[model samples]
Target: MTTSPTTTTLDAVLAGLMRRYSERVPDVQKVLDVMLDAGVIQSPDEIENDHIAFRTMGVPNLGLGSFEKIFLHLGYERRDEYNFVEKKLSAYWYSPPRPDLPRIFASELRVNELSADAQRIIHRYTDTVTSDPVDSLDLDDANAVDQFLHQPLWKTPTLADYQTLLNESEYAAWVIYNRYYLNHFTISVHNLKPGYNTIDEFVAFLQARGLRLNSAGGIIKVSPDGDLRQASTVAQMIDAEFADGAIFRIAGSYVEFAERRVLSPFQDLPADQITRQHRREGFETSNADKIFESTFTTQTGK
Candidate 1:
């Protein structure tokens, strides 16, 4: 817990992950180091133990899958998603044992956005509902929340209970955060809603303006609300011209699925900021992008 800057390889390794000097990265990296010392073999185990999958020693808010991708970069290949199912979720390995299973910052963030559909449902029906309690609703992503709210999600709570949960619970935090996530469309404003007209108009807007859909990889709806929101999957981005999350004016324009505000692969440190390398460093996979690509290549059945 007390990692002194002097005489600590763990500290040096962690410093590399936090090269950008991110506060979130350090706390999460610290968590990962503890887990490593405790003999956590796979990233998911670390997540199960402490509700985090840090790319570095101290950051927990980044996606667990991102760190897994880092493992692939090192060639510490594990079973596929099917293996996760086949082994009851125990198959895992790491590549380049130094950085082990962590990173200093977040990843490319276009695909991971909150869906408008989720916002429409959770916020729209928050009041006047008695059976499904808003607090009990799964609120990590808009799509999942949408799915959960479709039926009597909360065993029939009273309106008061719904309000209480909405006021003081993780569900509320999720919805409020999603509202923030959905607001980040730096592109042209074609529509403010997700209806037939809005979706169509937005699609036209992206095309007419010649805007690209972040990376080729589109979307992954964590909730039912995300059923409509999509971009390209990592593989789709690599192999196909269009993606599952979007029809490119074919089916529909991409909508947010993963939370957007998080850091992503498409982004990089700003131009003017000096890295000011730490006296020490966090051992990381220099070729993380290559590893990222491999995960998609191997998984897409290509």
Candidate 2:
């Protein structure tokens, strides 16, 4: 089948993101391989990405404001905002101009909310990357987006600083280490075949294949209305070297699976009609809050 122009452009963008994501988190490639080999997904194109998420530090000229410019230039419009006070995170979801493209979910840590000591430690590194790195790129260029996703904006942290941040917030430690790397890419399980249609079934499939999951909110976080269900693999740990020449295993990126239900208005309609209707879109604060735990040391066993 001849691919549409939009599909062609989206394919290039997704490929670029995946290439950078897989470089640091090799498990992502492994997971995709397993799904394909198991016949869970006929091909890479068959597995639709519901969205791609990024975690950033909420400092001057950083975080969502800076990170989002690239996507905005690519035709994404910002949507709802969510606050996770406990996690010290504020996130927003961006809708793609085209329905076939995946949504964008970017979250930033509210650094000011951290203790004075933690904030100082974070600033020591973030201050090094003075300007918004994304500003230097031409968002209209696909290669620019690809390079921006993988570029390290800040210098590496020392073991002391890393431990300090980890003691207060794992999220901060993660950002300091993996600067601007794609945090996670979610697979839209709703698009999969019958046996793997639901989050439960898909989770079971992965479990059976020996992949560990983040059980923060019972492995599957569902919205109060039961329309959105989500789960994620516990982040895999990899050796990370600190400035002091000591290597420690730290939490890396993970993969997520999402299944969104049709809206209540279309729930009672015929299957075909429901499929044609607009499905419930956007992120759930509570569900996403738990999904963020996928990178915690407790969940990842780092």
Candidate 3:
């Protein structure tokens, strides 16, 4: 199919996201290459991304508000809110202007909910971002969006501070080291061919190919309605250098697969009545809560 101008722009934006992410997590590129080699996808265009997620520290002049402006300018609208009290996170998903574009899942670490020491450590770096970085970007420009995705909003932290944040909240540590990084990109399993149309089947495919799956909350987390099934690969660890000049292996980004069921009204209806009704929209908090562990040391390992 010929790509539209809008689609072309969106592809460029997504490509930029992948480029920034792949630089830190080479496993993502490997996964995409393997998918192509195995004939799972004819090309990158055939792989429909269900959504892309980002992690940020919860603080003034930062967090979702600052990060979302770029997408918002591109006509994406906020759709749902999710709170993970246990993880001290507050997230929201954004719907794209067009159906062809992927959804956005951005989460922020609730800094105030952490210990004083941890909060201090987090602030030490976030404070360096004197102003909202997104404000300085030309949101309407695709190239600007790409630059903003890779722009570091804060100074690098010392190994000690990173360890302190890690001890308290792994999410905080991840943001501290990997600022504005794409946390994960989810594949719309239903869009794939029959052999890989379900989360269970896709998870098996990844495992058979030697990709480690996050076993927390099981390999697949299902929604209460059983309509949404999700799973993610345990993040790949990579060497990271701290401000103090020390290098350590840290958890990086991962790939996620999702299979959404049809809506109840469309399930028993005739084919005519069910036109455009096969996919379940929005996200599940329980499923996302576990998916967030993709970048944690416990899930990714040392």
For model 3, what is the alpha-carbon lDDT of residue 87? 94
Give per-residue CA lDDT, model 2, range 74-193, as digits (tens).
678999999999999999999887776789899999999999999999898888877888888766566667776777777789988999999999999999998877789988888888
Against the reference, the lDDT scores of all candidates come to 0.26, 0.85, 0.84
Model 1, position 30: C-alpha lDDT score: 39
Q: Which of 1 and 3 is the better model by TM-score? A: 3
Q: What digit string (tens of lDDT, one per residue) describes model 3 on residues 50-114? A: 88999988898999888888777767899989999999999999998777778899999999999
Worst 10 residues of 2 by lDDT: 269-278
Q: Over 4 Å off in model 3, which ranges?
A: 1-11, 268-277
* Cα-based lDDT at residue 284, candidate 2: 96
- Candidate 3: give its CA RMSD in angstroms: 2.6
As a whole number from 0 to 100, the lDDT of residue 88 in candidate 3 is 95
Off by over 4 Å in 1: 1-16, 19-22, 25-71, 79-116, 119-302
Candidate ordering by lDDT (highest first): 2, 3, 1
Sorting all predicted structures by TM-score, with the top scorer first, yields 2, 3, 1
TM-score of each: 0.18, 0.92, 0.92
